[model samples]
Target: MGTLRDAMGYPVLRAGIILLVLALLISIAGLYRVDKSYSSSGTLGEGMHYLGDDKFENEYLYHNRTLTLSSTNATISLLQGSEMYNYTLVNDSVTLHPEMRPAIYVFNGEVNYTYDARAIDYPYAVYSIGAFVIMLAGIALSFIGYTQFLKDVKGGKK
Candidate 1:
């Protein structure tokens, strides 16, 4: 134990510990509680069609819906682990924010989803605690190595 402590008695070790702790804190804050939601909207687009029994071929009545396809002013923050970009719905009641807010994806077969953010199903307490523990371990290891190096240098270990 004494020899181990000596190896970790360096300023570098202290800096390493601080860095590890900061990393852990940031990760926990960012990922510990992720909000999830789901939402969708239907729109009519004009395009070519098939002509059979007097059907409208290569034309659609929804042409005037062109103005409906305008983009909304919504920015999304995509997390590292998450596959979709989570965004907030703006004031517009009929616009889809780019972010994939985690709401119920399916209730019936309506094909329309709600736009809301929700906490993940799992509890974050456990993960937060584990991250903290790992950070502490990293700090301890750094400290030990630093002390050891200091001792070796002072005693001419070469």
Candidate 2:
């Protein structure tokens, strides 16, 4: 125990502890940032749903929509008719009413639609993961340094 304590008291060990603590603190900050960003992105609801279907210029159409809510506001985007006709509502709670247009068969009469309200930046999660990896490396380095110190102490006594 004394040797262990002495080993931990070394400058290198102290530096490793500092590094580990800093890494943990940065990781926690990154997680908080992730939560904040997610909340602000307004995608925290049950996700988008298929509103209904309509017809434009004798062609069948589908409308998929998603709503995102914030503290005092909401946003909605409608994926309807065509990719070039994405309708969005900002800071207002209203259903999408897509205007009728002549449907152009750009994809062999088949079109895929998707609405992603929860799409958010992931730099915070990346930062958190990177920090965690650094923290683990610091722990491993500290353990190896301490083991080397203990071996050195034992060798000196022998």
Candidate 3:
């Protein structure tokens, strides 16, 4: 009969050890804990102007990830087909990105005011969930391997 040392050579145990190590390394990534991030949508004053399509030294305003025309009146002229948003809460304000990318917006209110914009969505908790799955799989493998190791030891004893 082989000694308990021989049972340590079990292939399942080796794989389980590797997985356990990998799970530990992956757990480090979980420490980052990336939460969902987004700027709350807001409204500005009405009577937003149709600033020039090429420049915004005057009426164009962007705040809290929101782009709007700042005016005290609720009137906007859409010369063509375009999207427009207004915020009656604040005036012209500037800030840095909550994320990145400074987009060039062309609010063509000169010939005809046309505003175009889009909404973006980002995944939340995906990385944390992925790491957790790997850890769970590794734990399951380790448990199975430990049971196999016990069986191997008993068989060796016989």
Candidate 4:
């Protein structure tokens, strides 16, 4: 074990370590290349609606007012009928001031319409975690194998 070659004398241990390192690197890159797109949940109204903060802006019109809103306080206000509804900002939730649920049922024939924002791809995270665990296992196995190899060499065994 005095030289690099001597340290890697055990072929099985060396190959396992090398494969583990490659898998670790590939897993990291896969995580980075994973899909980052996510949706925000929100309600749809009759006219223009905005669902974002000062840094970003996502606008929608009457036809596309149904939006997946993020968990951020967006200055939501109807551009056409400002007085028709009252808006309240709450933590991760929004409230209609005048309680338009009844009116919505009468006009649109629906109590409310909301967009569900859920992650479509989650296997990337699972694979990344699995790779990390396997890498650790590989390192532990290599250590044990090297220790046993050294002991055998000292006892005059190959």
* Tens-place lDDT digits, model 4, residues 28-146: 76554322222344354444443323221221111212332222333344333334433333335443222111122112111132432222333445577767777877887688768
Off-target runs (Cα >4 Å) in candidate 3 are 1-8, 33-125
Candidate 1 error regions (>4 Å): 1-34, 37-125
State the lDDT of candidate 2 residue by residue for 22-114, as single tens digits.
Answer: 898888776542211111121223244432223212232232224322222333334446554332333333322244321212211122332
Whole-model alpha-carbon lDDT for candidate 1 = 0.41
RMSD vs true structure, all candidates: 17.0, 13.9, 10.9, 11.8
Cα deviation at 39, candidate 1, in Å, is: 9.1
Ranking by TM-score: 4, 2, 3, 1
Question: What are the models' TM-scores?
Answer: 0.29, 0.40, 0.36, 0.41
lDDT score for residue 105 of model 1: 20
Q: Give the 10-residue window scoring lowest on summed lDDT in candidate 4.
A: 101-110
Clashing pairs in 2: none
lDDT of 4 at 13: 71
Ranking by lDDT: 4, 2, 3, 1
What clash count goes with each model?
A: 24, 0, 9, 5
TM-score of 1: 0.29
- Candidate 4: list runs displaced more than 4 Å: 33-123, 152-158
Compared with the true structure, the alpha-carbon lDDT of candidate 2 equals: 0.45
Candidate 3 lDDT over residue span 84-145, tens digit each: 33222233332222221222232322112123322322233346566677667767776786
